[model samples]
Target: MYFSGLVSFLIKYNHLLLLLLSLEFMALSLYYGLFLFLSMMDYEFFFSMLFLVLSVSEGVLGLGILVMMVRSHGNDYLMSFSFLW
Candidate 1:
């Protein structure tokens, strides 16, 4: 699932929304794997909780950036932004 998300992220680079979605998908897969591993090993869930918190913050930051990009450029297309500008 993570690999699929990565592939999509790379292939769908034309849209910032798709890239963000792919990143969220990858984060989710990682969280699930971490939770399962910790549970099976009988370890504490503190680490998983920390990871979840960090991921949520990262997602919020991504969305904020997306909103700003869309507002400034009127769209979420990645190719619309030129580095040489």
Candidate 2:
């Protein structure tokens, strides 16, 4: 997705808030696109619905984590974290 590419670029450049926003945009686009393809068989439609739910939940969780990171660290650049050392 184009939003995913933007997210990667933002992450690479240490733009944390922008990365989270782009991730949300990507997930929203995925939900809309998947919803339009519901003309398939029953089983396939069910699987697509399941994937849509998972993606929405994943995006929400990611945003929550990012908010916590910003609160704890005063910023959210992934590269700024050094706990690995």
Lowest-sum lDDT 10-residue window in model 1: 76-85
lDDT of 1 by residue, 1-85 (tens): 8999899999999988999999999999999999999999999999999999999999999999999998988998887798513
Instruction: List, residue by residue over 10-74, the lDDT tens digit for candidate 2.
Output: 66557666666676677667766776666543335776778777877887887888888878888
Candidate 2 lands at a TM-score of 0.60
Per-model TM-score on C-alpha atoms: 0.94, 0.60
* RMSD values, in order shown: 1.4, 3.5
Number of the predicted model whose TM-score against the real structure is largest: 1
lDDT of each: 0.92, 0.70
